[model samples]
Target chain A: MKRFFILSSLLLLFLAGCSVQHKVVPAGNDVPSQKYKMEVVFPKGEISGIMAFKRAGGNMYGTAVNEFGVKVFDFVLTGGKRCKLKNVTGFLNKWYIRRTISKDLPELLNMDFAEDALEYVNYRQNIKYKLILIKE
Target chain B: MKQATIIISFLLLSILPVKAQTDNEIIANIEKASKEMTSLQCSFTQKKQVSIIDEVITSSGVLYYLRDTKLCWEYKKPYSYKFIMNGDKVMLKSGNTVNVFDTKSNKMFSQISKLIISGVDGSGISDKTRFDVSFATKGKDVVVTLVPKTKDIKKMFSEVLLHFDVQGYFIKEIEMIEPSGDKTDIILTDRIINKSIDEKVFHIE
Candidate 1:
C-alpha cells in the first residue's frame, strides 16, 4: 500500500509538470496595409493571384498565396528591410519531428541547435522553406 | 449508290449541329461577354496553379488591362517575368531574355484568351452552343459545369467549371479539365470593377 501511494504521487507530479500552458501574444505590424495582389506567369505556365504585401515595414514580407493554397514569403525585402528571423518551429504536426527549412543547415545539424533552426517543413514531400534576412 | 448515300447521311447528321454551335452560339457568347468586360482601369489579383515536382509553384504579379487585347502582366517577386500582350503579338520578358509570340498562330494563346473573355463576361460556358451546361449549387455559390458536346472542343478540354455567386453574376473561379486529364484552376479575387482604367496602361512599351 505504501509503494502504491508513492507511485501514484509520483505519476501525479510527472503529469503536473507536463501540463500545457499556452500564452499567445498577437503579432502584427505597426504600419497599415498598403498592399495589392498580382499574378506571376512562368515560362512553362502561369502562377496567378499573388498578394504583394508591399510597403510593409521599411522591410516587407512579400506573400504569394499559390493556387494549391500554400502561402510562402521571403524574410528579406526592399533596400534595407530584412528579417532577424530566428528559427522557431518547423511544420509541427502533432509530436512528429519533420524536416527543417533554415538556411543554417550546418547549425541545425549540430546537436545543441538543430531543432531550434527548423521553420516550415513537409514530411511527405521533404519540402522545406527557409527565410533569410536580405539587407536593403 | 445506296451504301454511299447512307454513309454520307450518317456523317452529315453528326457534323451539322456541331458546326452550327461554333458559328452561332459560341461566337455570340464571346461577343456578348467581351462587351460587358470591364473597360475600367483597375489592378486585380490573380492566382495561378502549375504542378511541378508533385507540388504546385505559385508566384504573384500585377495585371494591367488596357484597351483592346492589350494587357501587361508584371511579376514583382520570387522571379521577375512579364507577359505583355499587345493586339496580335504576345511578348514575354524574363531575366535577360525576351520572346515574342504571334497569338494568331498559337492555338494555346487563343484558347486562353477565349477562356478569360468568357470568364470576365459571365456568359455561361455551359451554353448549349459550346458546352452542355449544367449546375450544382454548393452553399451559396453555383458551380456551372460545361462539357464540350462538340468533338473538336472535346479534344481540347473535357470539362470546364465556373463558379458564380447566388446574388450577383460575378464569376469567382474557373476550373478547366483538359483532355489529357490534367486540370487548371484560376481564381480571381479582390476585383475592382468599373474604375477609370487608362488606355495606355495596356501598352508594353
Candidate 2:
C-alpha cells in the first residue's frame, strides 16, 4: 500500500509539470516585413523598443532593437509554432528568460499577424510584452 | 640619391602637419560652437538598419536641449513616447503612463542618459582620453570618427561618426556602428539654436 501511494504521487507531480507547459499553435506566417513598436513591462519597471519582422521561406524571422539602436534579440518562428532564439541582449540572455520568451513570442505571432496591435503576458513571470505595427 | 631623399622628406614634413592641423582646427571649431549655444531645438530623424534581417526602422522626433544636462526627446509618429532627463531624474512616458525615476536608481537608464547627453552637448566627444578621435572631410561636411578606447564603450559601439556642417560647426548627424554590424544614423534638421526653451519642458515633477 505504501509503494502504490508513492508511485501515484510521483505520477501526479509529472502530470502537473506537463500541464504547466504552455502550448504554441502553428499558424500562417504570411505577415509582411514591418517594424512594430514594442513595450516590455518588467516587474520593476517598463522598457520600450522596436521589433521588426521579416517573412522568408515560410518562416518569420524577427529582430528587436532598443530605441538607442542596440540589438536586443533575434528569433525565428517556424510555421508560427516553434520559436528558436538566435540571440539576446547580454542582460536578458539568461536561460530562463530565453525559455520564457520562446514560449510567449509565438503566441503573439499567432494572433492574426495582420492585426495592428498584439500583446502577450507571461503571468508566471509577470512580464507584459506588447507589439504595435507601425504603419508606413 | 641624397638630394631626392631630402626633397621627399620636405614634402612629407610640409603635408603631415597641415593634415594634423586641420583635424585640430575642426575639433576646436566644434568645441567653440558647442560652448556658445545655450539652448537648441531641432527635429531629428533616426534610421536604424539591421543587416541580419535586412530591415530599416525609421523614427522621427523633436529634440529640446539646454546647455548643461536637461534634454527632452519626444517621438511623434506611429507611436507616442517621451524621454525627459533633468539632471539625475529621468521621466519616461508611454501612451498615458508616466514613470519618474532617478538615474542612479537604474544602471541602464543612467548609461543611456550619459550617452545621449554627451552626444548632443559634444562634451565627451572631444575627450582624447576616452576615444581615439580622427577627422575627415566629406564634401561640404567635416566628419569626426571616434574609435572607443574603453572596453565598455567598444562593446556598445565599434565606431562613432559625428558629422558637422562647415557653416554651423554644430553636430548635424551622428552615426553609431555596433559590433554586430548594425548601425544607426541620427540626423538633426531645422535647428534653432540659442532660443529660449520653456523651463516647463524639463518639468517632470
Candidate 3:
C-alpha cells in the first residue's frame, strides 16, 4: 500500500509538472506520531528526505530535508485529508521547489517506471535517509 | 573602516612565513605533550567545500566547547551563521535568517558534532576503544593521527589529525578527514583556555 502511493505520486508529479497537488489521506484514526521515511522515484527523477509529524492540537509540525539533503523549512500541516508538503524545505533553487505532495492520489499518479527510477536515482546521485514520526 | 581593517590584516598575514617542524620532531614531542584543559574558547576560520560545485567557501568566527559535550559553533565573517544544539533540536541562524531544526532529521550531522566535541575534550578520545594512533612532527607543532580500528567511526572520518604546539600540549588545529575526502579543518588561534568563559556562551541569541 505504501509502495502504491509512492508510485502514484511519481506519475502525477511528472504529468502535473510543478502544479500537481495530489496526496493520500490515511484511513486510521488521528495518530499523534508517525515515523515516515519515503524514497520516491519519479519517472524523471528521485525524491528522498525526512519528515517528523507531531500532532499539535489539530495540526502537525513538520521538519524535512530538501532533495539536496540540506535542512530546510519546518512548517505546520493544516487542513485537507492529507497536507501536501509545499516547498517545506524552502530551498530557493531546487527541482522539488513549489512541489506539493500527499500520501494518497489516484491511479494516474502512479507510473510503472517509478520504482525503477527511484532505484536509479538512489544509485546514481543522492542517497537520503529521512525520518519523520507523527505523534499521537 | 571595518572592511579596510580586515583587508589590511589579511594582507599582513599573507606575507607571514609558514613555520612548521620536521616530521620526526613533531611526532616525538607531541607524544610526550599532554594537557588537562576543561574547556576552550577561541576564534577560528573555516573553509568549506562542495565538490559538486568545485569551489571553497571561507568563513571565520568564534568557537567554544566545554569539557562536557556542549559546544557552540559560530561563523561571524563573510557570512554570519551559527548552529546551537541543545538536546537534539538545533537553532541555525544565517545572518538575519533564523531556523529551528528537529534533531531526528539528520543523525549524521548530530553524531559528528558529538564526535568533534569528544575529540576536542580529549576525555572521549581517550575512552574510545577502536582508535590506533600514529604521530609525526612538523616544525613548531606535532601532528598526531588517529585511525579508527572499528567501523562506527570509519563511517565518517577515516582519520583524525591533531596538531599540537611544541610549547604547550595545546592543540592548535584539528582536521577530520571524511572517508569521502571532504574534510573540516579547524584552526584554534589565540586560545584562551580555562580563562573563565562566560556561561552565556552556550545560549543561542
lDDT by residue (tens digit), candidate 1, A107-129: 32222322322234434445443
Q: Score the docking of each candidate (DockQ).
A: 0.02, 0.15, 0.03
lDDT of 2: 0.81
lDDT of 1 at B129: 81
Error of 2 at B98 (Å): 0.7
How does the DockQ of candidate 2 come out? 0.15
lDDT of 1 by residue, B1-205 (tens): 9999999999999998876664455345444544566552333344333121112334455665544566666665545667677888877665565767788876555555555555555555535787787656688776768887866456556788887665554566777765534455656666655566665655554
- Residue B105, candidate 2: how far off, in angstroms? 2.7
lDDT of 3 at A85: 42
> What are the per-residue Cα lDDT tens digits for candidate 3 across A11-94?
887877533112212224244333333444444443443333444445444444322123333334454244444323222225
Which tens-of-lDDT digit does each residue in B128-184 have in candidate 2?
Answer: 876888888999998888887876667677888888899988888989888766788
Task: Give the Å shift of residue B98 in candidate 3.
Answer: 4.7
Q: Which stretches of candidate 2 lie over 4 Å from their true place?
A: A1-32, B1-5
Interface RMSD of 3: 15.3
Best by DockQ: 2
